[model samples]
Target: MREISFSVQALTAGYGNIPVVRDVTFTLPKGTILTLIGPNGAGKSTILRTISGQLSVLSGTVMICGKALSGLSPAALAREMSLLLTDRVRPEMMTCFEVAAMGRYPYTGRFGRLTAGDRQIVRSALARVHADDLAEQDFLAVSDGQRQRVLLARALAQEPKILILDEPTSYLDIRQKIELLSILLEEARERQLTIVMSLHEIDLAEKVSDLVMGIRDSCVFCSGTPEEIFAGDTIRHLYGIQEGTFLTRTGSIELPRTRGNSRIFVVGGAGFGLPFYRALTRKRIPFSAGILFENDLEYGTALSLAVRVHSVPAFARTMETAFGEAEKDLLACQAVLDAGTRIGETNAANARLLASARSAGIPVWRTIHEQD
Candidate 1:
């Protein structure tokens, strides 16, 4: 059996005696990444704080490598784990390099001085996070993204078996978030390090994590692999989303489809109609979409943004029954918007729908706003 790197059993934690999160339990194998996701104020940070030993546990236990966390000395725990928290730190006159070198403290001599080897590790950590260029800059002067990278580097400098991050992607842009998560994924695979982090971007968490836990109302709401957790309306229920639709396949959310009768018909396929669908919904113009295979990438988006959609079996030829139904809807609309999806063998039904629209004297538009 694989060894468990970290395990929490029925843990409850919060400031003082009041518990914010309770009955949280999970076990992660070495080198696996576990992500915690929930609505705001759901105690994700409290769970992390308890596991890191910064907050007192009200009940239950956290074990690191088969040893109880409470029994471990501070120095010993530092050797086993490193934390990148959400708290902002403004260090006066401290260079980024100096900030990163602090991770070596647990291994340093009595003077807390960095030797040549320690300096090399700090530099390597900075480079690993693409922050080596910021090494000599004032830590407080850098951008939020840069500060996040430097903080991650500091955690890496510790060379611990487990890394704990609290919303590490908070200040990062899309590119920076992807880059940071990529580095963590590589490190986990190559170094056999365990990772536990909280993420606001459930989409990214689904893509990156080996295990995902959903927290709500002070307890573990759900825990499973992303595939298991993301199935059906689990995410929607988890977030209490009522006004919009959540796409499990793409991890994208779309506004509710415009209500009432659809005035416009869309001939969309091959994922080409997504933007048009969204635009129409925003304009509060009810629209119908058609000729999409059930497995088409745009199928989910259409379901979310269109009043009605006509779909056929994936990989199967467009059925005449489906086409006839779409033609009926198209004739009722004032205009037909062609998403300009590539015409291919499987999606030839879309082309036929366009021809039918033209034959019926309905204006055809390539863009949503071009409609008469």
Candidate 2:
């Protein structure tokens, strides 16, 4: 079994005599990727700062590798852990390599001389971030994504057992964000590096981390594998997004809830439209269409919602003539009925279209709306 790298017990922390994090307790095992996720102002950053020794703990114990963290000197603590803060200040003239080399400051002598081993460590760190070619480029001149990778490389150079990051992907684009996260996961697994980071992107957090820590209402709500933390009601309460649906099979992205319409379909035509279509959208229901004229308003509305529509003649006037022209449309509705979809029509002339669906036992709701 992997050893526990960091353990927080009854930890309470904040700044200047006030506590933002209350009684937070969790143990992180070595080489595990743990993610902290919560709403803004939920004390996620406060907890990170507390564990990193940036803020003095008001009470309780934070143990790193069996040693009480509160008892360690600043230099002693630096040897065990490295922190990558969200708000990093870049040196105006330093190159990416120079910035990364700074992570070795804790291990260097008074003169800050880089030994052959130290130089090798720095070089490996740069390559880990895929930034070896940008070694001589000015840090301030690089894009936000490049700078972020450099900062991560710098932390890697420290060679600490534990790495803590606050919103590491804040400055990265979608592609860069995924690339950086993948790199972090790979490095942690390869080097047995224990990682804890805060993230606002729920999907990314769910994808890469072995454990997820969610903060809500000044308490630690839950901590476990991504599968356990991202269950349907867990996210609904965590983020307060009731419209969100967690896909059972996919297990990551939350889907937006689509309102299921009770009944709707039109043998499409022009000007015999607008009013009825507007009513359907306003009611927020599922709908279907068929036999539409090329320029029909009803056809346009159905297409917009991506409902299935059957194609037929551009015009149909009387019952016999229209039904004959719409024979294909009637058969197509059979597929919809097989799927148990409801059917309905607006005008009496087209009302017969609902008969087949009704004969198949699918419920039908009929109503008409006058356009303004």
Candidate 3:
């Protein structure tokens, strides 16, 4: 279990009259990586800036190590936390090593001479990020990904207990993104350092973060473990995605594309349709179903797949169509089957529909025995 560090209360700040971060409150515990995620203009960057002392808090309290951080000097704060923003402007003549060494300024003597320990710290930080080979290269000549890693190393050189990053993987290729995040995770685990970063890659954030804070409509709408925030409801609302399923495979979360028009009609109740429904979805085939009169495993599944539902009138005297509605559905399915569409059915009641399919020479699959 990690120790708790910062305890923020009703923190609010903005550029001017417009408040971006509106009355946000949260806690940061040491040895854990927390992620801030939301849409564009969700004030994620503002939160990072305010926490690192780059932007003044217009209201509320920011406490670090049980002390009020409002009046702390920027230099003093740097010794406690390091900030790595996305803004990249390389100086004309600075080498990668020189740029990374700038983090030592707060602890440097008046003469600005590098002590043996200072050089060792800089070297170690560069090596930790695998940026040591790029040390002698000119900052202006490096790629955006390389520059980001160098900056991260510089932050590491500060020896801060906490690290804050804003879109650290921005402008990096897929490989670089994974490498950079891997380095950060390693540092957090090895040194027991607290890390807080804002990210656009929701999937990556969910995978790496111990806790996730999501912003919506200028307020912190949700905050919890990654599993909670990345659940179907929370993720869909956060990203404004209308169609998709949150899948969990082997204890890992995935948001595979759920877009398609394979509207398969499943006819079964009492746990009969689960296997086919799951199989259709796994094979990227869209499906629907209905007429469930009571609680069934397939009922929840059909709802999850957004299947079209047509209920049968309960307390009916016979297992027959009500108000000719089921007859119309049968006709509709027959029309599709006549046009060479695939249809399936289960049990004795709907078995008539399958016989009709066979009569019309349409392929019908029976789940009477193999249904899960």
Number of the top-ranking candidate, with lDDT as the measure: 1
Off by over 4 Å in 3: 243-372
Q: How many residue pairs collide in each prediction? A: 0, 2, 0
Candidate 2, 1-372: lDDT as tens digits: 779998889999898889987988888888889899988898999999999999998998999988999889999999999988888676889999899999999999999899999989999999999988889999999998888999989999998999999999896899999989988898889998989999998888999999999888887877789989877567657766655444423444323322453245544455344444445555664555554544454454444442445544445443344454444445444233222222234233354555665676545554343431
Ranking by TM-score: 1, 2, 3
Best by TM-score: 1
Model 3 clash pairs are none
- Per-model root-mean-square deviation over C-alphas: 2.6, 11.3, 7.4
Which residue pairs show collisions in model 2?
261-285, 261-286
The pairs that clash in candidate 1 are none
RMSD of 2: 11.3
**TM-score, per-candidate, Cα-based:** 0.95, 0.72, 0.71
- Model 1 alpha-carbon miss at residue 87, Å: 0.9
Task: List candidate 2 segments past 4 Å from native.
Answer: 246-372
